[model samples]
Target chain A: MLERVDKAKKQIHNTVDALGRSVNIMEVCGTHTVAIFRSGIRSALPESVKLLSGPGCPVCVTDQGYIDTVMDLAAREDCLIATYGDMIRVPGKNGSLETMNRSNVHVVLSSDDAVQLACAHPDKTVVFVAVGFETTTPATAVAVMTAEKMDLSNFCILSAHKLVVPAMQALLSDTKNKIDAFLCPGHVSVIIGSDAYRPVVEQFSRPCVVAGFEPVQVMEGIAEICRQLADESPQVKSLYSAVVTAQGNTRAWELIEAYFEPYDGPWRGLGCIPNGTLRLKRQYKRFDALVRFGIEEIPKEEPNGCLCGQVLCGLINPPQCGLFDAVCTPDTPVGPCMVSSEGACSAWYKYGRRGKVHHD
Target chain B: MCLAVPARIVELMDDRGVADAMGNRWSVRTTLLPDVQVGDIVLIHAGFAIATVDEEEARKTWELFAEIAEFQERQAPSSKEEGTV
Candidate 1:
């Protein structure tokens, strides 16, 4: 594995040297961010070539208002919050779900577990906290479908979902950050395919490489992007060809379409993007917490000194935040970026931010 | 923010399939792939089979994973000669 990574590193170096220009590529997946750091790939690269992390972490990009809203729901006695392990410790306006120490809020691995929770507790409203890119929405959809099928009326979902394309467009439109090309999320690409990213490449004329999570996969993707830049060709290519196709996963898209509709959604740092979020369709609105419980959207405020928004958008690194390390360690994370395991801030704090280990 | 993967369908129901991903088994719907069946590896996202994957590609990925394991094994220096070296 090290040998392959070494070769890939050499290839990336050679490609970047040949390009002879500063290529500031942004990886739009949290897993890629962690993997890149874990593999020590950042240290292996030429100083001229910089890899930035985009708004790929679902939790990090999720708005503060939504976190406060979710925390509000968690405070209810008749409600049970079921969520993936990542969101438990994320700080809300007042406090986090983990801080409350309420027995009702449970960490579940999948949406199916939430469905089972609703089934087991027929009296209580079992609300599954749904958050993720396309990879996680289907599980929540399945849970909803299962609830409807089994006539489990108490089951609902608080969707904190965001789409990839609009976020990409938002990044491109931002004057604060200059994203040369995009190393797209591999897992997300499997569902949406390389074609979903065609618009970005065509409109922005920036290279898009849908890449896998492994270190070598990222290095190969970087090499591909460098090759495209060197040749002045900006196109969408699937470095993880084994999983991603041109059209992406049609069945999953259909299922999501059946259960949810495109609506204006909130992003933590980017604010609201039209049709950038998925909400339960009217047919399944009964299973939507926002609609079922009449939880009006509240304008929530972020922490005073948190740079999580800019951090998520690749506009700034974690160290730029004033509260980093001192007040934003994983144990006492002040922002969602510090809370979620896949978050860029968390990854840097855990794996990357240490003694300078520069490599040739 | 999309995360999807290809998994082989191990069980088929009316419109859903039980698929496996990296040893994790999941109940996924086949609404996207109308003609999906057991033994077929399907691309899944958000708990639905989005498309029927090319088996050739899936096999090649498994082959690569195997090669990775083999390479890791070969790269490991023998413990017997470790101290001497």
Candidate 2:
């Protein structure tokens, strides 16, 4: 295994040297960001090749308005909020769910746990704060289906599910961020498949390689991207083919299509992206929490001096932010990037990257 | 937060099943991959089986790695200590 990794490393260096120019590769997944840092891949890489973090963390990309809306729902007398642990510390307009001192909000591990919580509390309206990429959409879909099977009318979901491909498109269209290639999220590809990235590559003319979280797999993916760049051919390749297929899980696609439809949604750093959001279908309107509670969209207020927006766009690293370590530590995060474990800032903080110089 | 891991399905009951990974078990839903069965290794995310791991492909990847190691060994026959390679 180490021998193959050595070969891949050599190939990467040779390819980068052959290009004789700076190559910017953006890994659009928080997990990949953590893996790259954890494996010390950056230090091993040549100076010409750079890796940047993109808008992949669901908690980090969740708009402030959505967080405020969740806080509003939690404040209701008859409403109970169930969400993943990472969201508890993300600040809304007034405060976070943890600092709100509200007993109605509960941290859940899985969407099914939220369903079970709803089932237990038959009188109170339970709203599951669903947020993730395609990897987690199926779990939310299954939870909604389970709620329907058990006739749990009190249960509903406040979905902040964002599509990956649209966000990639948004990044490519922005002239400020020059991403030469992409290291696509492996788990998202497992559900959406490698073929889903073909459109992005075709339109933007950038190489996209689906990679696993392991160090070798990540190196191999980077090597493949470098190889494509050397040949001046931009294409979509899947190095994590052990699990990902061309069509992906057909049943997952069916379930997602059945319950949700594409809508324009807001991202924290990036503004409203057209058809980048997912909302419950008309038939499943009862399970939609936004409609059930009649919650209006609140105006978003960006955090003061927090460069998480810039960090998420691959324009800057976490250390580049003034408040990154001083005020935005994991314990007291001023931005969503420091709140979520998968977030780039949080990973950098936890993995001891504060004082070190970044390649970017 | 797309962090998924490989887990083996220990039990299957309709669309819901129990998947065990490294001594910890989770109640995972198999609705995404309805064709999955017991004892199958699946890639699970957020308490759901997203896809089944192809053992053959996994083996092939490992075999490629082994082939690379063998080629390196053939090139450096004098240094047969196996620590440097």
Candidate 3:
């Protein structure tokens, strides 16, 4: 395995050298960002090749308004708010769900847990803060289906789910960041399939490779991207064939479509993207927490000195921000990027790369 | 937020099942891929089995690595010969 990794590294180096120019590849998955940092793959790459973290972390990309809305829901005396663990720390305009001292806020492992909480509390309305990409949308769909099957009317979801491909298009359309290719999210590809990126490759003429979370898989995916650039042929490839197929999981997609529909939603760094957000379908409207509680979304601004927007765009690294290490450590994260474990800032801080100089 | 893992289904009770990966067991629902049975490896995320692993394609990916190794071997001797010349 070590020999194969060395060969892949050599191939990447050769391909980059042949190109004779900088090849910037953006990884659109937070798990990939952490895996790359933890495996020290960034340092091992050729200087001509650069890896940038994109808007893949769902929590980091979630708009400040969304957080404030969730916090407001948590504040209601009759409402029970259940969310994933990472979301509890994301700062809103007033404070985070954790710091607000709200006893109704519960950290759940899955949407199923939230459904169970609703079943247990028959009187109080349980609102599950659903947030993730296509990879996690199926689970939310299943949770919604389970709630319907069990006739749990008190259970509802505040959907903050975002689509991956639309956001990729948003990034590519931005002239400021010059991304040569993309490292597609592995788990998302399992649901949407490798062919889902066909539009991305066709429209933008950028190579997209669906990669696994393993170190060698990531290196191989990069090597493949470099090879594509060297050949001047932009295409979609899947290196994670063990789990991902050309068509992906059709049942999961069908379930998601049945329960949710695309809507223009706001992102933290990237503003409202066309068809970037997912909302409950008409049939599932009763389970919509936003409608049930009459919660209105209040526009909120990102905290001062938080460069999470620029960092998400790959325009700057975490250390480039003055607040990164000095005031924005993981223990007390002022920004959403530092709060989520999968966020680029959190990964950089945990891997001891906070003070070092990074690429532009 | 999109972290998922491949785990082998150790036990199945109707639609709900338990999968084991590296000694840890998780309760995963196989409703998405209901055809999955015990001993089959499935890609699990957020307490659900999203897809089954394609063993054939996985083998093909491994073969591609072997081909990469063979290509590297072929290129090494020619580059060395060029240096000597």
Candidate 4:
């Protein structure tokens, strides 16, 4: 594995040198962000090859108002919150779900558990905090389908679910950040397919390479991007074909189409993006938590001095934020970036703090 | 938030199946890939088998990595119209 990693590294350097210019490649998967840092690839790369982390972490990009709203739901006596573990520690306007220390809130591993909670408890309204990209969206859809099949009216989803392609499109259309190419999410590609990124590659003229989580896979993915730039060809290439395909999982997409619709969604720093958010379709509105509880999703600004938005856009690193380490450690994170394990800020805190980047 | 792992199916009944990743075991819904069998390996994401992994394709991907270097040396970038490394 080490030998193969070294071979890919040499190829990356050769390609970059041939191009005779520096390039910024963004890995648009939170898992890929952590993998890059953990594999020691960030520090091992040459100074000219800059790697930037994009808005791939669902927890990090979730709107602040949504956090406050979930906290509000947690405070209600008739409500029980079933959420993925990443969300419990994220701070909101008043406090976090974890700090409340209430028995009403429970961390669940899957949407299946959330539905089961609604079944087990006949009275309390069980609201699942659903947040993720396309890879996990179908799971929540399956949960909703199950609820409807079982005729369970007590279960609903407070969906902060986001789509990956639109977010990337929003980033490229904006002029501030300069990204040469993309290391697309492997699992996301498995669900959405490699062909989903064709618009980005064709419209924006950026190469998109899908990669797995291993060290060799990551290094080879970067090398592929560099080769594309050097060769002056931007195409959609799927390196992880064991699961990903040109068309992707059709059945999974069918489930998504049946349950959700596109709308303008709120993002922390990026603001509201058109067709960026997914909500339960009109037919499935009966299971919509926001509608059932009469909750409104008002946009809220980032906490005073939090740079999560800037970090999401690849404008700055986590350390560049004023509150990154001193005030926003994982134990007492001021922002979602530090709290989620797959977040870039959390990755830097755990593994990439000492790595040298192009900035250095 | 999208975390998925490859696990082999140990048991199957209709859409529901038990998947084993190494020593750990859990029930997974194979509704996406309804054709998946008890012994086939599939990628499990959030209690569902999203896609079946072809072990042959996985081995081929790594083998292609070795050809990447040769592909770089063989083809001249300016002359070619298309083909991935």
Give the number of the best model, judged by lDDT: 4
TM-score for predicted model 4 compared with the true structure: 0.92
By TM-score, the better pick of 3 and 4 is 4
Q: lDDT of candidate 1?
A: 0.79
Whole-model lDDT per candidate: 0.79, 0.84, 0.84, 0.85
Docking class of 4: acceptable
True-structure RMSD for candidate 2:
7.8
| Quality class of the docking in candidate 2, CAPRI style | acceptable
Q: Write the per-residue lDDT of candidate 3 for residues A1-360, one digit (tens) a residue.
A: 788789999999998988899999999998889778766788889877888989999899999988988988898898899988878888887778889988899888778888999989999999999998997788889999999999998999988899999999998889997799999998889899999999999999999999987788999999999999999999999998777899999999999999999998888888888999999999899999888877777546789989999889888888889999899988779998898878999877876463332455
Error of 2 at A185 (Å): 0.2
Off by over 4 Å in 2: A352-359, B54-85
List the pairs of residues colliding in candidate 2: none
Instruction: Write model 1 residue lDDT over A1-360, tens digit each, in one string.
Output: 678777767777787788788888999988788667766778778887877878888888888888888998988999999987778788887688878899999887667778889889988999899988887776677788888989899999999877899889878887887788999998788778899999898888999998876667888889888888888999999988777789887766777888988888888888787788889988888999999889997656679999998887777888778898988887788988888767888777876665453211
Please state the error at residue B24 of candidate 3 in Å.
Answer: 2.7
DockQ of each: 0.20, 0.28, 0.24, 0.24
TM-score (0 to 1) of chain B for each candidate: 0.63, 0.63, 0.62, 0.63
Tens-digit lDDT track of model 2 for A20-87: 99899999998888778766787777878888899998998999989989998998999999988778
Model 1 residue runs over 4 Å out of place are A1-8, A355-360, B1-85
Model 3, clash count? 0
How well does each candidate reproduce the native contacts, as fnat? 0.36, 0.64, 0.59, 0.56
